[model samples]
Target: MRRGGAATRPSLARDTGLSKPTVGQALLDLEQDGLVRPAGRTSSGPGRTAVLYEADPAAGHVLGIDIGRGRLRLAVADLAGTVVAKVDEPNRCRSASALVRTVHDLATGVVAQAGMTLSDVVKTVVGSPGVPDRGGRMLHLAPNLPGWGRRGLLDELEAVLGPGLLVENDANLAAVGERDQGAARGVDVFVCVNVGTGIGMGIVVDGQLFRGAHGAAGEVGYLPYGWTDTDSEGWTPSTPGILEQAAAANSVVKLAKEHGVRNASSAREVFQLARQGDACARAVVEQEATKLAFLVASVSAVIDPELVLLVGGIGSNTDLLIDPLEKAVREISPLSPRIAPGELGEDAVLTGAIATALRAAQDIVFDRRGENLVTQRSGVNA
Candidate 1:
């Protein structure tokens, strides 16, 4: 189905290395199950016309939700992996209950826009901020969304979305999204560093996600910065992490303030000032680039990826930081990997979630069909 819009039986058989009879049987079964439909005929030469088949777009649907710190994004896609509807809104829900309700409502809204209902959704994948503990009870290392790490959070989400819901780290999903469809496509070894409200990384090695034991592989925020207490009082030895304390959005704002950049409330504003030739803001940006370069060096030293993708709210500002970051990496590390901004921007996580959900949905559909077929054969044997 992914090869093209439509294909003939002989073409599918040739492409898949399957016998023509086997291909015919599989197509018949799919057609019977309403997953494939005839799409007219094509004749190459003087031979008889061959009937072409295409996947039915309405066979099943999957849902992808990205629960970010400040926004909620939801997307609905058909079995063919085509997005039908997407919705994005401000994330004002602070408490766990409110977050759950917001997700449910947003999902319903998007599915409705796609002419689907909750029951029509075969599976759902959510991309969140933190790592889920064993048994999926609570998330940890997520400070951006308040009340998100409470116990039974996954249960609450499953209660609303059904038993087919799967949750994954947002940064990891973004990396997968980039590798599958964005900047890192076809790259076997790469690291996706998301530097926004906090810092995290997604590591891909040998064409696969290298999630270490206990799922804490890419938690780069905890890297020791060795900064003295006088540098920033906000982060101490007992704080969440030093790298995040020095490089995240809050840290950027604090740096700007310390540099006497008044009236710059957000990191975005600080970047704008830097672009306008403000000396103080430029200094802050330079420091940020240096810190990020160090982070990249640490990653390269350990994993030696072919490329490093800078993503998230602050990291994607490549126009200002890319050149400096590349130069800094070359200065500090022997392995100078290609560093670039993520192409998908905020939509990376959502796209990854959708891709994951679609895969799960396809597995479920095919497994059920296979099970039914086995049961029918058993009955005949009996």
Candidate 2:
């Protein structure tokens, strides 16, 4: 369907060894159902012509929300995966109702801007920075935002959006987003490690986001690798943890200060100094890269992903860490995954949420059509 929906139908039928008339009829039915529409005429050599059609962009709209540490981003996209309108706002306020209201208002504004209405929005997907259950209760503690772990967050969002709301962890969404539209576009097995305010990983197995039994499969932030604030022999999932304290922005700043570098406030500052060839800054970055490498190698030993996408606040910008990290990983593991930065940057989460929402919309259409077909078979709607 991506290759000029109408013109490719005959080709698809030929490739699949199906009858051209059957494919033509199916396409006609799809167009009548409002899922496909004539796009335009395709130009060709002398005397040859073909009309093109595509998936109807106006079939419906979907809303994607990415709840970041300091900001909330909401976007409305068409059926063809184009972002028609967007809204971004600071999320300093901690009320769940307020967040839902913000999403509702933003979605409404986006729809209006696109000359659509609330009814046009088929589904909504949210990417929050924690582990949320199917019931919408955030468990396993969000590192950046406080009070996000409480239950009913999904229900509140759904109550405002009406129906079809999906809540997913930010990193997991980022991983799928990258796989679908960014760096890992054609890869099947991969993992995306988001190294920003904290470290988190999104695992993709067989081209799908693989959330383990407890939905905490890629919780790299809690992966204890012999580093912790308190003296302990073994570190468990319930431990205080070390990734956030050792490699996060705040940790970078503190480590810089300990090395007599004063007033280094953020990770960007540290990276800038390192770029300028400051010995202390270079040393700090190298140390952090080593730790990150060890973490990745450990994950690879278990998941054995083909590629690893690096995303989030620090990971997106710190491509310099790759060379050193790769070398470090070679010492611990025989297999090294191809590591790359996410092409979509911070937008990965938003794009992924939109993809998820679009999938839900497609499911809705299929289910309703199936039910209608059943009714017709029974002479109920006939």
The per-prediction CA RMSD against the true structure, in angstroms, equals 3.3, 4.4
Best by lDDT: 1
lDDT of 2 by residue, 57-174 (tens): 6677888889887678888888778999888787766665566677778777877888887777888888887778875444455746655566776677777776767788888999
lDDT of each: 0.86, 0.76
Backbone steric clashes in candidate 2, count: 0
Report lDDT (Cα) of residue 164, candidate 1: 67
TM-score (C-alpha) between model 2 and the true structure: 0.83
Supply candidate 1's per-residue lDDT for 355: 84
lDDT of candidate 2 at residue 307, scale 0 to 100: 88
338: Cα error in model 2, Å: 1.8
What local lDDT does model 2 show for residue 33? 75
Q: Per-residue lDDT tens digits of candidate 1, residues 13-91?
A: 8987767876777777777887778989999679889999987766789999999877899999988789999999999
Top candidate when judged by TM-score against the true structure? 1
Pairs that collide, model 2: none
Error of 1 at 295 (Å): 0.5
